[model samples]
Target: MSVSLPSALIGPLLVFVLLDGFIQGSVVSLLPVIRDTLHTGTGPAMWITATQFLSAAVSVPVFGRLGDLHGHRRILRVALGTVTVGCLLCALAPTLGVFLAGRVLLGPLSATLPLSVGLVRDRLDTAASRRGVSLLVAALILGATAGTATAGPLASVAGGGRTVLWCLAVLAAVGLVLALTPRISETVRLASGRMDWTGAVLLGLGLTLLLGSAAQGAAHGWHSPPVLAGLLLAPVALGLWVRSSLRSSEPLVDVRAMAGRAIAPAFACGFAAGVVVLGGQGVTVAFLDAVPEEAGYGFGLPQWQIGLWIAVPALISFLTAGASAAVGRRLGYRAMLTAGFLLMAAGFGVEIVGYAVMATWYAGHLLAGVGIGLAVSGLPTVITEGSPRDRAASATAVYYNLKTAGGSIAGAAAAALFSGLLTRSTHQPSLAAYLLLWGACGVLALVSAALIRLTPRT
Candidate 1:
């Protein structure tokens, strides 16, 4: 079927995608500044990042299922509006606790990307849908890159860290406006399933505990009572969620839907990629911050400069993601994933060498950017291709949730590792921490490669 959307609709949708990235990227980009301003250690700062991911991890699947039940466009509008409020709260927050409250509110709103993707699928014909998906994905990557890269400059322009939060609030408001534009249409109005409140609550609690425990374990010691309790509760909650889901007349997560052969592997690849890429990025940022200026290990760049440096890689990733869509059509999804993982592995290896020499680190970051772009872009396609027609949105949501969770795991792990190294050494630990992180990322990439290879060709 040939579908013709008004030209006006495209700009608003595109802006929404970009804004989604801007909010997420801005939050992460603020990590260094927040750490400095709050007088909090790396562990707490890491939790700031982890909280956003954990919240999103808990919300995405639930939101996706809801979107499918109600309407994708309606959900998008509500989410964007809620995000605007959250961003405003963040801007107004006077303390770290208030800021964290804002982040928790914003977390569920992060499902905007998947919801947007589903909207595009619902609105467009096959050809236009494919192109729309590609563009939306590219926008998402660019938004993240731009947020990370430009946040520093913007903060500098605004005159302080607080100004950056104001800037994010403004961007979020713009997104909300775009979301309200009348040109957008409600699509995929599925039969209303009973809202599985019990299952959702159980799953959310389980994931939050599991992720929270993973994040805090590094800081408090794994054996700490709180950490142990969270860990202990995670499995029990998960088992309960599973059991409830299996028995429910209308389940929340739909476990059986996830059992499809192709969908399972696609999610596995995405989750694994999320862990390595996010972890690597966390380590790189931390290394930049902790390294001493006098020691050849540090750039000693200000937050703005570091933020700008991040942009270079982000731009490269955006460009590569846009390119990968076309390439995937020709080479197929498996080939693209394999190639992406290899490039990512190569990037990590280069980063390790650069740290060893303590020279020209930007080149390594650029390589890593390209790898992340390529790998991340291919993930949606893999999930979409494998999913059942009715469950496509939920399946994609599952992938995104896993990806967010993986990133949290990686960030927490990096924090723990770096903290451990610092405790042991009086001198700069940049080289040691980075080397270990790079090696870990390389191993992750290799595992992804192997997984891709084992999967049957589409």
Candidate 2:
């Protein structure tokens, strides 16, 4: 398990992950544009993102199974191709509905991270694999920063959001080429059994219902029939999905394995990170973008400048990710996870001060960037610790799926907050919403730190 890979062998894969991260970050940059272009309200704007998370939540696991059943390299190609097509749809769409449909297509590409993790494990020796994974993880995190940073400037210079989408399409196409560049031999893990189609549908529908309720509740009164029904149906649907998973010959998630010590905590951390960090991303931008100059409350920066601001955390995280594995080696994953949460908490606390000093803002974001880098680096290693080599992709899928779902839930909550508070501030989430978000994220980061401590050492 310790073969060193040629840079040529690894470079394309790293570039691909960076592209994925960039695509991920760029989507946030595009959210405000997409919302404005579609003429949707603030509450509805979040659906553009929430829907992606909900859809990706279900699709990631399914792709993981396909990767296991067939091959990681083959499935990755399918993911890259699907993203290229999805980018095409988004770039050309004439209306909000079409754009959302395009967002659904983009969900399948989420499997790339887990799939690539599997590829690294299969193709490299143990020591080399560890280095590759660390590099890949850093690239994924760094690309997001680089993309977010670059996109704001791109938007400022490119003249429009649609052009940004076109840029994304070209990026996806490049990723497709890189995926094709590697003559990697496909590694098939699971050699038998059919897919859990029933499980996938139930899980997807259930999550959609629950997340939909949070979103719809903001637009319609919480007492509205559709919202009410969604609230009532979500748990029942999810419960059934769980039951089906437990009884199925080939469950989408292995209940026993998931319940195991190391894996369970990793999933928990992923979910927490989703709500507190990933989910907060959109709101963070809104806080900077929506606050009017007259309001005298926010930085009053332009959209692209706000993007550069947002990218600060990502840049710091990117720089810190290189050291994450080494830090974990020196201080144990438990310590790394704990430290990450604390840094995030500190960052949130710094933001909550809402001081006029722009430097204060950058400092908070930079702290968070480093914290997030550490957690992202450690969480996956923990999840995959005792997993079978063949099952690595699927196992990682479980973590990613929950993380996506957590982000969806947090976004729904933010949308609801925006709906109620928007009357006070027409452009952005109200000041109240911003305070609540940072406060919640801070508390949750503290909680996550505690939980990581309880994860039994492998």
Candidate 3:
């Protein structure tokens, strides 16, 4: 059966995907600049990044479930609208508090990715669905890469942080319009499921506390009362939420889904990928900022140039991810994942080597980007294939939430490493941090490969 979509539909969908990714990438990539402008310390800067993830972690599950109950199209439009508002708040934010608020609002908007995926699945026939999914994933990679690459240039051209926010706002508006125009069918509708308000609250608070503690602990010292309290409270809250979920007839997250063999490994791989992608991104930006002009180590590129540099990998990743989707179709999902991990591992290895030879840094970034593109492209397929039909959206949400949380953890860890390693005599760390981080990426890829091998072929 042929599934035909209006020519207009494709452009809108693509725009929506691009804008969503662009916002996320831009925010993370521009953090260094934001920190400089705001005069915020490393701890606070980490919070800016961590808060976005924390918000998404809490909101994705809730919104995804709600999306299932209501309509995905409705939720997507609302989410995109929220993104516009958030971008505006960010642009106008006079203080750090206001900016954090904007980030908090942007959390629910992360639903853009899954909602976009669901739209394609619901609206398109099998063949079109495959193509749509491929394009969707490509847009995601592109947005992320573009956001990183363009942020510096955009900020520079726009005249400051405020200008970047305005640009995001305009893009978000375009996404909102696209989301509103087409009425995509909502395929998955649960017959009866009460919103687990208590579960939602508990989960949100628990994640915030836990993630906040992790991000802040290194900066403030883990022993600090605020950090300790957050850490201690998180597990307790999580335990309570789990108990609540198990008892509730309609749990917010179906814990059983998480326990499935196929699903569990998918989540693990997504989490690992998040750590590497975000950690590598954070390190790249920081490395650019810290490298000295006098030493051969630094490019001494302006913010705009640096942004472009950051973007190059993302662009490469976006293109390669599309290629990966084709490979997945030909090679099977499991093979696709394994191949992606291997590529990523190779990329990280290249980075490790390049860091030693400063001249080769650009090549290392390109390799890393290719690896990220490949690995990320396969994750959605893995999650979908692994999930039970009944709980697919929730399962997808869980995988995503874990990935975002893992990325936040990586950002924090990297920040701590960079700060601790700062020395008067030596401008850059002994390259040990970069080596360890890259090594960790390689290990994660290998582990993902093993897991992919262990899962029974579909």
Candidate 4:
């Protein structure tokens, strides 16, 4: 069956994704400024970022499943509304604790995209759905690019970061308005059974413990009492979650299906993409912002310059993501996926060897951007199409959560590397820290490529 893109539906969905992406990108660039404004140290400031991802790891699946049980459009509106409150809270937060709480509420921001995917699947034919999904992902990257590119300039124009935070709140409110409009169509409520709250609570608790332990381990030594307690208890919580899910009639996630051939490899790719891409983000920004004389290695760029450098890769990914579906069809999904990871590996390899040269470093980022764009766009499509139609949102959530989990692990690992390789005289992270991080990311990309090759073609 032939289908056309429905402007009424696509327009609002695009706005939601764009708003989410913009919030994500702008927050990263604004973190240092926010930390200073709140008079918090680096350790606590890091929690602001960590909280968003941690909460998202739990919220995505819960929201996705809710979208399946109810209607996607309805759930999409709820997610958008929830995030608006989060943005407002962050904008006006008087203390670090309040800001972190706001970030937790913002967790549902990640769910908007997956909910939109369900809508697309419900409303469009397979071909149209692929195009729709590609467009939404592209918008997300594009929005991130815009946010990164503009955040610094906007902050400067407004004279502080609070103004920028207000701007994000306003954008989220606008997205909510759009989602609530009558134009956006609701998806069919195909799934049955009530939400598995017990499973959700177990899963959320498990992830919170796991991520919290990693963060604390980085701050305190791994053997520290709190860290040790968290690390030991995390597994028990997760195992219980798994067992409970297996017994439930309608679990929050299909744990067994996630391990099946069709979905498992895609999940692996998602995790690797997180490790190779999101894992390196903070390091890249820090390297660009570092004063060479003080750090003994870096460009010593200002905030806006740093944002611009990061935005270029995001911009490239926007283009590549928009085109990924067409390219996947021509190259075959397996070939495209394998090639994408290889390109990311090549990109990181270039950075590892030629980091001293600005031109070469940029080229590396551009290549990685293309690879990430392709890989991320393809993985969701693979997962959704492979899943039972009624459970598509949950499957996508699993992929997303795995990706976030990988990033969390990588972030902790990078912190360890920096701590271990600090330059004594400068008291800053040494060049060895960067080299090791980049090299590890490159190797992970290469491994992902190999795993993709072994998976059956999509």
Give the per-residue lDDT digits (tens) of candidate 2, residues 371-447: 98888777877776656677778888888877776876787687777766654544545677777888899898999
Which pairs in model 3 have colliding backbones? 149-311
Q: Which residue segments of model 3 deviate by more than 4 Å?
A: 1-11, 29-46, 125-127, 186-191, 288-305, 358-364, 422-424
Each model's Cα RMSD: 3.1, 3.2, 3.1, 2.0
- List TM-score per model, in order: 0.89, 0.88, 0.89, 0.95
What is the per-residue lDDT of model 3 for residues 264-363, given as tens digits with 9 covering 90 to 100? 7777888988888878666776567555644334545665566667667777887877776567667777787787778778777777777645558677
Model 1: residues >4 Å from true position, as ranges?
1-10, 31-47, 189-192, 288-305, 357-364, 422-427, 454-456
- Scored by CA lDDT, what does every candidate get? 0.75, 0.77, 0.74, 0.86
Model 3 compared with the native: what TM-score?
Answer: 0.89
TM-score quality measure for candidate 1:
0.89
Instruction: Please provide, for model 1 over 1-458, each residue's C-alpha lDDT reduced to its tens digit, 9 standing for 90 to 100.
Output: 33344556456777887887877777776787877776678766776877777778777877877777787777787777877888888788777788788888787667876777677666666556555666677888888777777776676677767888887888888777767777777775463567788998998999899888987887789889999999999999999999999999788877875665666666777878778878887666556655464444655666656666666787888888877767776787688788888888888888877764435566777777877877887777667656544455666788887887787788778877776665334554546777898889888888888787655585
- Model 4 spans > 4 angstroms off: 1-4, 291-296
Q: Rank by lDDT, descending?
A: 4, 2, 1, 3
Candidate with more favorable, higher TM-score: 1 or 4: 4
Query: Model 4, poorest ten-residue lDDT window?
Result: 1-10
